[model samples]
Target chain A: MKRNSRLSLALHTLSHMADDPDRVRTSADIADHAGTNPVVVRRVLGRLREAGLLTSEKGHSGGWKLARKPERITLADVYLALDESLVATANEDSDPVCSVEYALHRRVSGVLREIEQSLVKRLGETTISEIR
Target chain B: MKRNSRLSLALHTLSHMADDPDRVRTSADIADHAGTNPVVVRRVLGRLREAGLLTSEKGHSGGWKLARKPERITLADVYLALDESLVATANEDSDPVCSVEYALHRRVSGVLREIEQSLVKRLGETTISEIR
Candidate 1:
């Protein structure tokens, strides 16, 4: 399966915003810096706004800006904003009759849950300011 | 991007093999149980064999079997056998001139590396025997 880079892209865009909080960054400009299309930039940043990490303005001089200081936003915050699981598991519901599959799924799921928790905790320890 | 489930699939397949070590399972049989195609099963199991976790034999009775006891095989071993990164990074080299991009890439890479190492360590703590 392909790996998602939304987190990376969001962080990249946020860091650019943090570089100059007063300067509004248009989707086209951010996309140019991010080596992606404006639609993708807008899509990712839109999630960031919904997460309360960013704000978008409309009309003349309209663009995206961080809602709070970089120090106030942690990597964990960004991660949660992206709304994706940190790990993947097999589709357990896909094969209900197989006891072997059930047992395997249970164990793997438990371990993955632990790993994701650990990752989120570690991420919470780091703020966007620390990275920027 | 879609999350890859190869690790979960490998663990599931290994647990099944561990349940009856004396029984040799064919690719088709494993595929049926794995809710995947035979080719997918063979491809994944082929990596497990190359990692010395299983053995494949040829002949009318030929199939696949664990090369060692389940207790000796850790989830980390299975993960390494699959040879996939636990985390994804943006294509950093895609934009070389942007310093903001560079800073974001460096920090993100460091965090992901730490997360991967932590994940591998946790996986190493559990073995196929425990899961089975």
Candidate 2:
């Protein structure tokens, strides 16, 4: 599994936006601050916008701004916007004939599901406002 | 971030081993059952052995077996052996000037640590014997 840094980057960007909600920040500005490329910043922020946590404008003076107050944006919202599964099974297609494998998959899947729920619940407990 | 299937694969392999403790399973055999390459199986299982959950013999008729009772092995053991951090920060090294990023990192890090502890605790609650 490859470690994902998008959530970290997004949270960093969002907190910066919350610090000065009245000031519209461009993707370039975010990218520079994040020490990454603008494309990466745009991609992450685009998801946040789609999730309605952010709003973007097209004009020169227009850029990105938070759609809702920082207090309302939870880390769980950011996690969902990133659209990555918290856990994944090794066998994409399991063999039904292998009962041992079947039982193992079922048990691990149950545990992973619980872990994901706990993670998301914890994320929901934290807001961007609180972090910033 | 790419989703990792190593833990799932390791659990599947371990449960299979537990199913028939008397059988010595080779990496090739495990790979065939896992629908993955032998090298991948060796890498994952090697980590398990290093963590004292498995034992391996090198010559002919030599293969892999559980180092401890199935009931003694926990998913947390496998997770720690994998040597991958449960959560990774977007910025490997944070910039001191960016207080917002600093604060976000600290807060998210705290939540992630708690999540990891919860996940490990849940994993410890289930032994390979229970799953098998």
Candidate 3:
């Protein structure tokens, strides 16, 4: 559940960010609150930045801040930004010779794919503003 | 995604079993086919047994077999049986002093819980018989 951990970390970090959307938060500051390493915080922040939900400024008095209003961003935005390795069922074999294995893999994968889409949809129902 | 791996293993294993639902296959046989250890196979089978998906027997000519017909079993049944520590969002703190953390956890947890329910529902749509 490492991926889940990251998702939680990002959500919590963003919740804090949502509290003060305009305030700049250094990786150290975020890490301190989350009790995690600054590097980890930076990585997650970087992902959000790339996704346009956050902005990071470099230099002596620079850090991270929300790029948009909290209400504009959804939990789905944070989750989709991270795109962590999926918890999915796939064919274990290199080339499944057995039709049974192949068919099972195909069917399970399709179900998981659909589930992921619905998950994203459900997550989008809640905005960052609503969470905080 | 180890949980997903186990899910895949159980599904593929069951698909094979569906091919010959009445066949008494030992853990060793399953382990060999899945390229995993017998102990691992036994552990997974044990969970399935508890879920009433499969049955186990002891003695010289004993192993594992489906408790019911493949047509009656669904992918959700296999997924539900394992209950592989959910991939969920949760409150990391013992007592979240920050209202932001508390609200985010409660909100995200609910969203993920709903998503899981949808996932199970989607999985239930496909029976083991349909996969193979």
Candidate models: Cα lDDT each: 0.78, 0.76, 0.77
TM-score of chain A of 3: 0.89
lDDT of 3 by residue, B105-128 (tens): 676566566666766776788788
Q: What is the TM-score of chain B alone in each candidate?
A: 0.87, 0.88, 0.90
Instruction: List ranges where model 1 is wrong by over 4 Å.
Output: A1-3, A90-92, B1-3
Greater TM-score among 1 and 3 belongs to 1
Each model's TM-score?
Answer: 0.86, 0.84, 0.81
A20-130, model 3: which lDDT tens digit per residue? 788898999887777678999898888988999999999998999999999999988988899853545443454664665566567666656665676677778878777
Residues B52-92 of candidate 2: C-alpha lDDT, one tens digit per residue = 99999999999999998887888778878886565543335
Docking class of 1: acceptable
The interface root-mean-square deviation of each model, in the order shown, is 4.3, 4.6, 4.1
Who is ahead in TM-score, 1 or 2? 1
Q: Write the per-residue lDDT of candidate 2 for residues A31-122, one digit (tens) a residue.
A: 87777888888888999999999999987787899999898999889988887666544335655547756666677677667666776777
lDDT of 1 by residue, A1-132 (tens): 025668878877776677787688899998877778899889989999999999999999899888998889988899889886666553446646567566666776776676677767777887876663
Candidate 1 clashing pairs, residues 3+ apart or interchain: none
Model 3: how far is B20 from its true place, Å? 3.7
